[model samples]
Target: MQKIVDTAKGLEGLKRQWGVHAAGVILSRDPLVDVLPIHKREQDGAIITQWDMGACESIGLLKMDFLGLRNLTILDDCLDAIRENRGEDVVLEQLPLDDKPTYELLARGDTLGVFQFDGGPMRALLRSMIPDNFEDISAVGALYRPGPMGANAHNEYADRKNNRKPVVPIHPELAESLADILGDTYGLIVYQEQVMAIAQKVAGYTLGKADLLRRAMGKKKKEILDKEFQPFSAGMKEQGYTDAAIKTLWDILVPFSDYAFNKAHSAAYGVVSYWTAYLKANYPAEYMSGLLTSVGDDKDKSAVYLAECRRMGIKVLPPDVNESMARFAAVGQDIRFGLAAVRNVGTNVVEAIRRCRKEKGAYTDFYDFLRKVDAVACNKKTIESLIKAGAFDSMGHPRKGLLAIHADAIDSFLDIKRNEAVGQYDLFGDAFGGGDDAVGAGMVVTPQIPAGEWDKGDLLTFEREMLGLYVSDHPLFGVEHVLTAAADMTIGALAEESSVGDGAVVTLAGILSGVQRRITKQGRAWASATLEDLGGAVEVLFFPNTYEIVGQYIAEDAIVVVKGRVDRRDDQPRLMAMDMSLPDITAADEVKPVVLALPRPGARRRWSSGCARC
Candidate 1:
């Protein structure tokens, strides 16, 4: 007995590759021979260990996959928004799977906030499929995959929901196995659990053995499958299932299991998917706020989110040090833009401004604010960035004017604050009362806005940066009529056009969305840029265009109109820009400021606020 035990232990201790494995001795440099195989590759100069479950058991090692995920962040934000808005902290685990609002949202393709199912194709699928329950959502989530090529899953789901087809079961035993899933997609084999059930019931395999088979099937392992299929088939035959029926079921399953998604994984993602849907449906303000806040640094995404908010009739207010928070904040249905998102302005500046406001109330004006905070914290570049981003719009200064006086204003503000702090009062301090006298003295050096000088391009640029989308007005304001007549299109009409020929001669107007740089084969830089209108986004190509035109206007959210013909470069239809210019695209060829007729006092303020969203 001792000899037998020793022999078994010795054989188990052998490392086969690096040394020898003759006569169970494992004669190697080390007595405790390393049984695990060292993985080697030329491309990446390292020996990787192949120690997955099967590899571990064979080579006497252990292995586990450590997965980090982003869905948790989505989960956290959803719960926080829910708690903050409704006073109800929802534990998604306790929420019913059959949520009506969730399904309604899925049906409408308003899955922007949804987790995995937020893609363009998925959104289109949701609009058509019209899911009625959580099971439908889960099944759609599982079926709307690459396997169902050309949107077969979406079509199948939509057809089943509209009673255009009957739900069919593959086998009698599968009736019970597929009953729960059928509630949504009428017994579609859309989940891994269904596969395991079929294996367990039809093949008479134990759950553990079935799981191994499932894993083997998922991995498409030939050797393990060859070892397992005989018993599986024999067990099914013993249960009186005909070979033809078995083959049919197996045929349907093998392909899907080839891409068979994990039902557990989809269900977890569905929770976030449902939450985003719920947020979009129920709390547009808070949802937009969080969405804007999360993507503040990503100008492209921020602009897109702003467009979505506008479509939802939610306003995105411009940044004001007094009125706006550092992060996107909800002001009724409107989302106040984040100050931290402005280019060149560090997030620390936003936090400092917010801290100053919280410590003291709303700032009285420029001088009052300068007294509390250091102007040096926001440097020239930072001030210009904020000015371009419309951070001081609420101070009643046009962006151009604010930028013009930025340096002098900072210097005078710092001087006044320093003097005030040291109790150095002016000679006439108590003459008209101390407060009135201080205000009058400060007023002399304070920056002033010119009465009639709001430039159209500047307005659009400022609004574009602050609101994250073109609001206040589009750059092609007067040119929209021309674009409509010339290209037979508006900003909203681009998507309907076919991707054929040289496309259309589109004269659409938009804020210059972004410029993406790439190096050509000749090692010269070229750019593919985006121009966004109120309608949607259009891609534009600029090979040598950036050099001729002003590059300074390419700053984040600068409004520019592209008068280029539409063309398809790489299968995707895009605008091939022949000419691009700033907001003054008038045939007159001169920049001009906008003139407004004054309304009654009440209507004047109202018009100004409404214009903020134009």
Candidate 2:
């Protein structure tokens, strides 16, 4: 055991693997190959330096990080969509920083898809701060991290910004010098740049030396911090600052340096965050379409954006063969689901559909679509998926009716094409049809079936199966009142950072799906299910004790009310079920009256005598 312990200690700080940085690149005046060891990456054969970023920097080489942000791509797509759909050229760089609508959107906490302010806690902070300008956005980004949040800096910043708390300088002696540096952040030390500026102005340190002090403070090394403080204090005293003021400033710098973010970096993020909010405020459909298209393949992400769209009052129509493109597109004031997002539908099929629509105009009907679509791409499975996904609904056919007749329609269309390939003419072709167009039309007859549609639940299930979500309506639509009356919060609220703390009891009502029962190592049965409300879905766990009582009610598509303690161990919250019951609208609607009667002496005897007389 001693030998093992010694070996583990020796390996604690040793490098275990070599990895390439995601975005970091080393720059050198001389050829990199001549200056440093280099090798080709095994995965892509890209040239890479042997030394890591810190090692390269230590040798006087410049290391630059070129980050590829998805939000930037989303912005580009959104701008193009706005130009194409609305004929508006929206240049993000030229967008006004003080746009009133943008600030209003942030103030309302409707930042579900905005870049930096989209998280629940960040949204709540934005609401509390009621950011009225770009500076507030940057400060919120800097203060939302664990370190600042743990220190309650975000709340303090919010309070200061909203005038709930007064902003005061660190020291009256250095007030004039520090205000210029920290005024934008409501007198809070939010940025590393501010720290450097403070040292330069109040302590009379050179810019380079102040930066060294900033780095030393940021590292939080006792020895380095202790050494850096002597010069800071000496310089402050030389500048006529009192010893007490210097000590007070030093006390703040020591702890705050740990979480102070780079002001420039926060401002850069603020620009992108503002751009997204601006576009969402002005062109919601275009922006949401771009956002949905960016995550079209990811169902969970798509569901989140879809919910956001609903909240924005933008209707996200289901996939329509004529209206939808390969990816999500803005259709007037609404957004249309993309054909490529439908399960079992390939890009090739979506391309074929688009090509056919462009070449032959909008699909007139289901029969016309079958005749004009590329037969090679429009296979039986693809057609069925499109039908189930509501892609063919605009052709005036019920989804169930189309599903019933699609096979025969495809077979009949194929037969006509086969005959045409063989150069065979029907005996009654010319007699029934005068020209090629008429002959083609007369070859395959559209099948007629009952006009009945599937039940709401079945339709939603098919949409979930094919489109990965319910677009026409959600399962919790009609039962919302009942759920609202019983549940403490929605499933989506569980995802918010500020919604509930760990182990806090909460009640939620939603339709249960994906229920799985398993036996624990202790040979006890336990279960897990996804509880989905209108807002979103959350996982609910039923341990052995709870499972024994609620096992009978646990099944797929079961609408149940769950009472549980929130488990926020993961990035998202899950519910540890304490009780579960079916959502009963009748029971929820019943208002039992409380008949209270004051107790009287001999009341029981009087009631018994009255009953005997009766």
- Model 2 per-residue lDDT tens digits across residues 386-467: 8889988887889898889888888887776667668776767777554334434666677785599999888889989998
Candidate 1 per-residue lDDT over residues 66-160, each given as its tens digit: 44444556456545755665676767667666766667667767665466765666777776677766656666777777654333555776677
Worst 10 residues of 1 by lDDT: 19-28
Compared with the true structure, all predictions reach lDDT values of 0.64, 0.84
TM-score of each: 0.69, 0.88
Pick by lDDT: which candidate is best? 2
* Residue 23 lDDT, candidate 1, scale 0-100: 22
Any runs in candidate 2 off by more than 4 Å, and if so which?
A: 1-13, 418-440, 497-505, 518-524, 565-573, 586-614
